[model samples]
Target: MQDEDFLRRPAAPQPYSLTPAILYLSSDAVHATHKLLQRAGRNESCVFWYGERHGDNASVHSIRAPVQRSRRGNYHVEPESMSEMVRDLRAAWRPLAQIHSHPGVEVEHSRYDDAMVSSRRILSIVFPYYGRPIANWPSDIGVHEWQLNYWHMLSSADAMARVRLREFADVEVRDFR
Candidate 1:
């Protein structure tokens, strides 16, 4: 399979809904971090993150980093800023993954994103298409999956792809075989 196949998944025909409980019930710090990453994305209408990863057993809470942008409504983060974030993460004994959002933007991973993630785990959260009815984590060149409207995670490594969605409640898992 091609690299694109590694990031692609079948899309559902409808939108899924995520309940608050589902978002609050994660036992994995990584999973909780992902949820907090989502809120930080929506909170700033831009992007936010912990600047570092967390300890395996630490609770994913009270971690946030605000991104700076120009007055022209353009977002920008410098190399110095990233270095500082990593420094802070090191101080807090956290992981090296950075989470941020692409609010009101459909652009895929850009050169800048590549540059940032090149040295760390970069998680990009693209917000609502505003009114666009596209699938969650939808992309013509990437992965797309359904979670009964809760969460979607797409990954591609070594031409191997995995797409999985976690539901907000108990739901049937369809077997297409």
Candidate 2:
């Protein structure tokens, strides 16, 4: 579709619920995601993750979708690559969520994004990669959970706060020096 498809805002707030209770992200995983989005600039970039979800905690361990140049754009993921990535990741780790960057500051899900979530009920995170990367992330991120009909965008503070809650207390972030 149009280049700004992903940038558009939704018409109305849709019903949604946070799934898996807790999400634990590794430092390396966050770093790699930031780097990929930065390199892509205004264009959209994404990464998938494989993790273990037990009761209320989901421990994300590794990145399943690597940066592939074949589908570099501001609004879409290459169909072929996406298909292959999902297939490959499903074989090993459960596809927990899809992380992407927005060219603009708006972090809400667009209509296109809602349509994309048609059949899959997964978590979707939109990062506002506007300025310099910072050490803190809870203050500048968008978290959305797919419900039966629509995606719900959680408040940035709430999302971060939830992640920092006791459920994700034992996460380990590996330092790549």
Candidate 3:
């Protein structure tokens, strides 16, 4: 094989087919995620949404916060930490999204975030104001998905169609603080 062919990037991501097209989240899930991120104050923190998927629809049934090192602008979760956090979760559960906090309203994923995301097959949602979340649900929040070769932030209209926050839904919360 030519050097160019050998050096070429891996095949384009498989379109994340295993992920649901529309994910329904419970208000409690949002509340729990915000609460965990807020505890870090000015530092950025992260959590994960894990659940089951049925066809194009999925419901978030669990929230998990890995033991991560948070800074004002970035956070890091060791692979081992992530594994330990999810080890006890239901065997059938799959991670739907990784929810993180930013210091400002710039919800766009940073270069660091793009590289640090746990999985290309899952969504990545970023909240502003260190997760205090001044704006309404989904508003000002950055919902990102991996497509082609990049992480694309969904527009408001797209976000609405993709993720819905219900007033009430059952969600189990686990934090590795």
The TM-score of candidate 3 is 0.86
The TM-score of candidate 1 is 0.35
Ranking by lDDT: 3, 2, 1
Top lDDT hit:
3
lDDT of each: 0.33, 0.58, 0.81
Q: What is the RMSD, in Å, between candidate 1 and the native fold over all Cα? A: 13.9
Clash count in backbone of candidate 3: 0
Per-residue lDDT, model 1, residue 111, is 38
Candidate 1 lDDT over residue span 11-75, tens digit each:
44455333221111112333343444344333322323332233322222223443444221124
Candidate 1 residues lying further than 4 Å off, grouped into runs, are 1-48, 51-59, 70-74, 83-92, 103-107, 129-177
- Clashing residue pairs, candidate 1? 7-143, 16-148, 16-149, 17-149, 53-94, 53-95, 54-95
Steric collisions counted per model: 7, 0, 0
Q: 1-177 in candidate 2: lDDT tens per residue?
A: 465444566554554444447777766667666775666555676666556776676667656544354122344555665666555333435656777676666666776666654236457877775322654576576777755555777776558744542233332222111
lDDT of 3 by residue, 64-153 (tens): 888988887778899899989988989878989999898887787766777778899888999998999565668689888898788878
lDDT score, candidate 2:
0.58
